[model samples]
Target chain A: MEILLQQIVNGLVQGSVYALVALGYTMVYGILGLINFAHGEVVMIGAMIALTVLQILLAAAFAPVLAVLFSLLAAMAVCMALGYGIERIAYRPLRNAPRLAPLITAIGVSIVLQNLAMMIWGREYHSFPLPFSSTSHQLGGAIVNDVQVAIVVIALLIMSALMWLVHRTRLGRAMRAVAENPAAAALMGVDINRVISATFMLGSALAAIAGFMVSANYGIVHYYMGFMLGLKAFTAAVLGGIGNLRGAMLGGVLLGLIESLGAGYIGDLTGGFLGSNYQDVFAFFVLIAVLILRPSGLLGEKLAERA
Target chain B: MSINKSALLVAFGIALAGCGKSETASNPASAPAGELVIKIGAAAPLTGPQAHIGKDNENGTRMAIDDANARGVTIGGKKAHFELLSEDDQTDPKTATIVAQKLVDAKVNGVIGHLNSGTTIPASAIYFKNGIPQISPSATAVRYTAQGYKTAFRVMSNDAQQGKALGEFAARVLGAKQIAVIDDRTAYGQGLADEFVKSAEANGAKIIVREYTTDKAVDFTAVLTSIKGKQPDLLFFGGMDPQGVPMIKQLRALGVKTQFMMGDGGYTPKLIELAGAAAEGAYASLPGVPLDNMPSGRDFAKRYEERFHQPIQLYAPYCYDAVNVMIAAMQKAGSAEPEKYLPEIGKTEMDGVTAKIAFDEKGDIKGGAVTVYQVGQGKWHAVQTMGGAPAAKP
Candidate 1:
C-alpha cells in the first residue's frame, strides 16, 4: 500500500512534466494541423536559455528566486521568438508545397537547431542553477526533494496559465477559429499568418517552461536533449489523441503513471529475472497496447476536428 | 597515321605520368621539411552522445603528439616527429569498423582508439588483424581485455573491479538488506551490472529488482514504481551519466526513496547537473587510477587547462598518459619500428599522468586502484581510493 502510494505520487510528478511538453505538441497540431518536430528543440532552447541566464545572474549575486524568475522570463522570450522564427522561415516556405515537404523540412530544421546548440555550447553538459538543490524533505516516508516539487508545481502553474490563455482571451478565440477553419477564418479576416505565429509563440513558451523544469528537475542537459523528450511528448499527444489539448496533457500524465507502475509491478513479478533497465520499454509497450485498443486515442472525440 | 596516333597516345601517357609524379612529390612530404614523421591513428566517438569524453581522449593524444614533437625525440636513432590522424567513429560500431580499416590502410605505427566498449570490441579485431598495437584509455568492458588480442591494452580497470567496488559500497557501506539493480543494457552497463549483482547478492543483499533500459530512455517511472513496493534499501544503476541523471530525477520525483549506487560509468560532471540536487549524497565506484586527486593529475590538469584553455574532460589525463606510455615503450624498445616495439610494449612501466603505466599478462593494467566518489552540492568529491575492489560487502 505504501509502495503503491509512492509510485502514484512519483508518477504524478513525472507525468506533469510529460504533459506540459505534450500540450505544446497537441496545441500546434490543433492550430497548424502539422507536427512541429522542432517543438522539442524549442523546449531544449528554453532550458539552455534558463541555464545561461541563471549562471550569469548568479555570478552577479542575484537572490535565488530573482535569478530563477529572470532565467524563466529570458528562456520564455527566446523560445517564443525561436518558435515564431522556425514557423516563419522553415515551415512557411514549404507549407503549401506537399505533405512530405514540411515534414522533411522539419527534420532539417531540427538538425539545424541541434547543430546550432552544439556550436554555441560546444557539446558539454550544462547544469541549471536551481534553488533548494541541496534540500530533501521527508513526506510520509517518501523522500521528496525541492527540485521535484518545483517540477510538479511549476509545470502545473504553466499548464493553468496556458489553459487560461487559450480559453479566455480574444487571441485564444482567434486561434480556435483558425484551427477550426484556417481558410474560412482567413476569409473572415483572422490574420492567418499572425494567428499561426501567435499559436507557435504561446505553445513554445509553455514548452520552454517544461524545458526549464525538466533540466532543473533532472540536473544536466546538452544540445540534443530535446530529441527523446520530443519523441516521448509526441507519443503522449498520440496517446491522448493528437490535436486534443487536454487529451495530450492527460496522455502525458497517464503515460508517466503507467511507465512507473509497470516497471515497479511487472518488474518485481519477474523475480529479479528482469532488471530495471527495461522501464522505458515497459512504458512504450503500454502506449502501443493502449493505441491498439483505442485506435484514434483514449479521449479523441469523434467529430469537430477533434481539437 | 598509325605512327602519329601511337605518338599521340605516348604523349598522353607521358603527360599522365608527369601529373602523377608531381602530385606524389608535392604532397609526399605532408610534414615540414627535414622531419622524420611517424603516423599514429586514433579512433573516437567525435560526434555522438559520448563525443565530449571521446574528444578529450583525442585531444589528449594530440597534446602528447605535440609534446613529443616539441621535445624533438629521437626514434630508431633518428630525429622522429609524431603525427596523430584522428577519426570520428560517432559511437557506431559499423562506422567504427570502417574508421579502423581506414586507419589501418593509412599504415599508422600505433593507435589509441575506440572509446566505447561496444565499438572497441569489434574494431579491435580489425586493428589486431592489421598488426597495429592499440591502447584504449577509457574502454572498461571486461571482454575488451579478455578478448586475447596481443596488441590491445587499456590503462583503466575493467568492469570486474568497478562492479565489485560498487557492490561492496551497497552491501557494506549502505547496509541495505534488499537492493534493486538496473543497467543501461549496453556492453559496459550489462557487464558492470552483472558484476554488481553477483557481488551484491553474495554480500547478503537480497536482489529484489533487476531490470534494463536503453540509453535513449528518459523515464524509469514503471521500474521505480515496481521497486517502490519492494522497498529496496538501495537502487544500483550500472549505466553512464546520460541515463543515470534522468533516472535519478524520476526516482526522486516518483518518491522511490532508495539510495542510488553506480559504477564509474555514472561518474561525470553532468550527472550532478542531470540529477540536480537529487544526485547529492549518491556514491559510485570508479575503478581505475585515481588521477584526479593525485599529484600527477593536479599537474596534468594545469598543463591541460593551459593548452586547451578549457577544463579537461573526465578521461583526458588518462589518454594523455596512454600516449606517454606508448612513446616510452617505443623508447624502451630502442626503435619506433612496429616489430621492435610490438613485443616490448607489454613490458612498460613508465610514469604516466594517470599512473605508472604497466601491463600484466593477459594485457591487464598492473596494480590498478578503484576510487569511490560522491556527488555533494552539485559537485563531485572523491571519498576513498581502495587498493583492490573488495568482494562485495562480505
Candidate 2:
C-alpha cells in the first residue's frame, strides 16, 4: 500500500509537467490546426532563459523563491516573443498554401530553433536553482512535493482562465470562429492573422511556464531538453484527441501516471526477465492498450472534428 | 621457307624489345622519395552520448603527438610525426566495427581507443586481427582485459577494482552490514554494480534491495523510498554522474539518509556542482592521483585551464599519459612498424602525466593505485590508496 502511494505521487508530479505542455499543444492544435512541432523547442528556450536569469540572481545571493519568479517571467517573455516571430516569418508564409507546406515549415523551424539553442548554450548541461520545488510534502500517508502541488494547481488555474477567455472574450471568439471556418470568419470581419498570432502567443506563454516548471522539477537543463518532452507532449496531445482542449490535459496526466507506476512496481522484474535496456516498453505498451481501447482518447470524440 | 623464317625472327625481336623496355627496373639511386608517416587509428564516440569524454580523450592523444613531434623523436634516423586518423563510432558497437575496418585499411601503426566498453569489446577484434597495438585510457569493464589480446591495454584502473574498494569502504569502515544496490543498466554501469554487490556480500554485507535507473532519468524517489523501507545502511550506485548526482539529492530531499557510494564515475566535478554540499557525505573510489602530485598536476591543471577554459576532470591526465606512452613506445622501437613497436611497448617505463606507465605481458599497467574518496564539504577528498589488487592476467 505504501509502495502504491509513493508511486502515485511520483506519477502525479511527472504527469503535471506533461499536462502543462500538452495543454499548449492542444490549444495550438485547436486554434491553428497545426501540430506546433516547435512548441517543445519553445519550452527548451524558456528553460535556457530561466537558467540564465537564475544564475544571475544566484550570483547576487537572492532567495531561491524570488529568483525563480524572475526566471519564470524572463523565460515567458522570451519564449512568447519567439513564438510570435516564428508564426510571423515561417508559418505566415505558407498559411494560404496546402497544409503540407506549413507542416514542413513547422518542422524546419523546430530544427532551426534547436540548433540555435545548441549554438548559444553548447552541449553542456546547466543546473537550475529552485528552492521551493526542492521541498517535499508528506500528507495523509502520501509523499509529494510543493513543486508537484504547485504544478497541478497552476495548470488547473491557467486552464480555467483559458477556458473562460475562449468562451468569453472577443479575441477568443475570433480564434474559435477562425478555427471553425476561416473563410466564413473572414467574411464576418475577423482578421485571421490576429487570431493565429494570439493563439501562438498564448500557447507560447503556457509552454514557457511549463519549461521552467520541468527544469525546476528535473534540476538540469540543456539545449536539447525540450526534444524528448516535446515528443511526449505531442503524444499526449494525440492521445487526448488532437484538437480537444481537455483531452490533451487528461492524456498527459494519464501517460505520466502509467510511466511512473510501470517503472516503479514492475520495471525491474520485467527488465530483468526480458531486457533491462528496454524498460520503457511496459508503460508505452499500456499507452497502446489505452489507444486501442479508446481510439480518440477517454473523453475525446472520434467523429467530432470531421463533424 | 627463308622469307617465313626472316619474318618470324623480326616479330620475335620486336616482342623481345617491348618486354625489355617494360622490365627496366629502377636502380636504388633512381628510386622515388622514400617516406613513411606514422599514423595511429582512433575509434570512439565523437558524436553521441559519451561524445565529450571521447572527444577530449582523442584531443589528449593529439596533444601527445604534437609534443612528440616538437621534441623530434627519431625512428630509424628519420624524423616522423605521429598522426591520429580518427573516426566517430557514435558509441554503437556496429559502427565501431565499421570504423575499425576503416582504420585497418588506413594501416595505422597503433590505435588509441574505442572509449565505452560495449564499443571497445567488439572493436578490439579488428585490431587483434590487424596486429595494431591499442592503448585505451577509459575502457574499464572487467571483461575488457580478459580477452587475452596482446595489443589491448588500458592505463586506468578497471571497474571491478573500483567496486571492490567502494564495497570494502562501506562494509569495514562505514559498518554497513545491509546495503541497497542500483545501476544505470549500461555495460560499464551493470558490470561494476555486479562487482560491488559480489564483494560487499562476501565482506558480510547483505544487499537488501537493488533498483535501477537509466541515463537521462530525472527522478528516483519511488526507488529510493522503497530502499528506505528496507532500511539499508548504504546506497551503492553503479552509473556515471548524470543520474548519480540527482539520486543523492533526491535521497536527501525524500529524507532517506542512507550513505551513498559509487565508483570512479561519480568522481567528476560536475557531480559536485549538481549535488551541491549535500554531496559532502557521498563516497566514491577511483584511480589514485597521478605520480607527480604537486608540480605535475598543478602544471596540468594550469595548462588545461588555459587551453580548454575549464577544469580538467579525473581521467584527463591518464589520457595524457596514454598518448605519451604510445609515442614513447614508437620512439624506442626505432621503427614505426606496428609489428616492431608492439613488443617495445611491453618494456616501456616512461614518466607520464598520470604515472610511470609500464605495461606487463597481459597489457596491465604495473604498480598503479586505486584510491578511495569522500565528498567533504563540497569537495572530493582522497582518503587512502588501495594497492596490491592483482591486475587482470589474461
Candidate 3:
C-alpha cells in the first residue's frame, strides 16, 4: 500500500537519526567498555548550540546556508570539547576503578549538562530555522522533504565514513588493540589515554551531527530533547550488539521502521482501543523481546572469557 | 521564679508584637503610612517551555499593580497598595503545589496564577485550604471551575465553550464532512480535544481517525500518514503553539491539505513565525473578543508593548483583567483581606481591558466570549466572535 511506503519513508528518516546517535553509544562502549551516559547530553548540547548559532546568524542577516554551515561546525566543535572535558574530568580518573563509578559519573555528567543547558537556554522550545525549503515532493502518494532526504543521506555517509575509520585506518587498528587489551596495548607503546580520548571525541562529533539533523528534521529544539532520544539510541545499540558497529546501524534503522509502521497501523489493527500514542510501548516491547531472544544482539559475537 | 516567668512572658508578647509590627513595617508597601498592603501571589510556568506565556501573565499582573498604585486605591479608609509575589511553577504539577504552599506561607491576600490547568487545578486546592482567593488568567479546563472550590476563578472561557465554537465552526463554516482529531494528551489538550470531538460529532461531522501525542513530540509523519489515508476534510489538533507549529509544518510537508484547526494555545503570533508559510489558512479559536474590538485593548496593547518590548502573547489582556477584577472585589468589600473580599469577587462588575469582568456561580467568566481566527496574508484575522453556546455554527 502507498500508506505503507509512506510510513517506511518516515521510518527511514527517523531511523537514520537514531542510527547516528546509536553509533555514538556503541563506539564509546566499544572502545571504553563503559556506557558514556553523557553522550546524549552532548547531543542535546549540539542541537541547542546549533539553534542558538543559527538564530544569531539569521538575526545578523546572514544567508541560511552560511548560517547552517557555521551552526553545524560550531555544534561539532563545542560538543567535541565537552566530550573531551567529560572524559578527562569524569571518566579518566576512574578508568581502572570499579565500572560502576564511571557509569554513575557519566549519569552525573548528563544531569549536570542538562541543568546547565536549562540555565543557559531558559527551558523553552525554540523553533529551529529551516535552512532549506520545506517543500514536499510526492512519490506515488508518499511525501518526501529536503530535511528527510538530507538526514538519510548524511547518516549513510557518516556510517560509511565511520566504518572506514574503524576498520581501514591505522588508528582504527590501534583502537581495536586498545579495546581488546588496554594493558597489553599500552605495553606495546600504544597511547591508551590518547586513544580513549580520541574515541570520545569521534563519538561526540557523530552525536553532534545527529543532534543537529534531528533538530532540523523535527524543526524544534529544547533542553530535555536528548533524554528520551538517548534512551532510544541506547536501546538500538543494545539491539544491534552494543560493541558491534554495523549492528548498531542496522538495529537503529530497523527500530525506527518498526516503530513508525507499528504506530501507523496499531489503531486500525486494534479496533481503536489503542492509538499511536502507545507507539513508545511498541518500541520498548522490541527492546524487551530483543533482550529475551538475543541478549548478545542481532549481529553481536559471543566473546570468550579470559583464561 | 515567678518574676522570671513573668519577664519571659512579657518578652514573648513583645516578640509577637514585634513580629506583627515588623511584618507591616518591613513590607515596603506598608511603610508606616497607615497603608494596607495586600500581597497577591502569582504562579506560572516562568521557567519552562511555557515561560513566554507565563512572563506575559506576570507582566499583566505587574501592570495592574502599577495602575492600582498610581490610582492610590483605598479600602475601608486605608490606602491599599498591591504587591505581587511571583513564583515559577516550572510547568510541573508537583512544583505548582510547592509554589502554592510557598505563596500561602507568604500570607498573600489573593493569588493570580498557574498558567496551565494542570498547575492551576492542584494549586487551587492549596489556595482554597488557606482561604486565599485564586484567579487564573488562562487555565481553561472545565474541571478547574467545576471542582466546587469557591477559591478558584478564571477570567477566560473554559474548553467547553471554546471547543464547541471550534467544532461548530469546523462543521458549519468549513463545511467539513469527515474530520480527524489529534491531541497532545495533556489535561488541557485532551480536555479541549474531547470537547471538540463531542461537539463536532454532534454537528454531524464524522471523525475518521483519532490520534494522540505528547506535548513534547515533534514528529507526526506516521500519524499524519494514517490520517491522510482516511482523507479527512479537516484536521483538529488540541495542543499548544509549540506542538501545533511543527505538526502543521509536518502535515503540509507530507502534502496533507486538510484544513488545520487548533484552540487558543495555537492562536499566537509566535505560531505564525514558527510554522511560517504552513500556517496559512489555519483556523484557531481564542477565548474572548479580539484585542482590536475590546474598548481598552488597544491602549493596553500599546502600554504592554512599550513596557515589555514584545507584543502580547495570548492571555496577557485576560491576566490584566483578572488582577483588576480582584482589586474591584477588594474595593467592593472595603477590605483587603481574603475572607472579606472572597465573597465580593463573585459579585464584581468591572470594565477591564479584556471584558466586563464578572464570574458565574461556577467561577467561570459569565457568558465568556470565543473568537475564531483564520490566518490570512500571514496574519490572524478574526472571522467570528461568539458568546454563550455558539449558535449551530452559522
**Per-prediction TM-score, please?**
0.85, 0.85, 0.90
Candidate 2 residue pairs that clash: none
**Would you list the C-alpha lDDT of every candidate in the order shown?**
0.78, 0.75, 0.86
Model 1, CA-based lDDT: 0.78
lDDT of 3 by residue, A1-307 (tens): 8999999999999899889999888988887889988888899999999999998999999998899999999999998899889999999989889889999999999988987897798645677886677666787777888788889999999999999998999889989998788889999999988998888889899989999998888777878788888988898898999888999999999989988999899999998888988777777888899889998799988865422
Residue runs of model 3 more than 4 Å from their true location after superposition? A55-67, A94-108, A122-124, A301-307, B1-35, B389-394
In model 2, the Cα lDDT at residue A211 comes to: 91
Give the C-alpha lDDT of model 2. 0.75
Query: What would the per-residue lDDT of candidate 2 be over residues A36-105, giving only the tens digit for each residue?
Result: 8888999999999989998899889998778888888989999889999999988887777877888888
Candidate 1 C-alpha lDDT tens digits along A79-194: 99999999998888776776778888888888888878877887766666576444767777665667777777877787778788778998988988988888889999899899
Query: lDDT score, residue B66, model 3?
Result: 78
* CAPRI accuracy category, model 2: incorrect
What local lDDT score does residue A242 receive in model 3, on the 0 to 100 scale?
88
Candidates 1 and 3 compared: the better one by DockQ is: 3
Clash pairs detected, candidate 3 = none
Highest DockQ: which candidate? Answer: 3
User: Model 3 — interface RMS deviation?
Assistant: 1.9
Model 2 spans > 4 angstroms off:
A1-3, A31-34, A57-66, A87-112, A131-136, A141-145, A182-189, A267-279, A304-307, B1-52, B83-90, B94-109, B129-131, B289-295, B389-394
What does the lDDT read for residue B71 in candidate 1?
Answer: 81
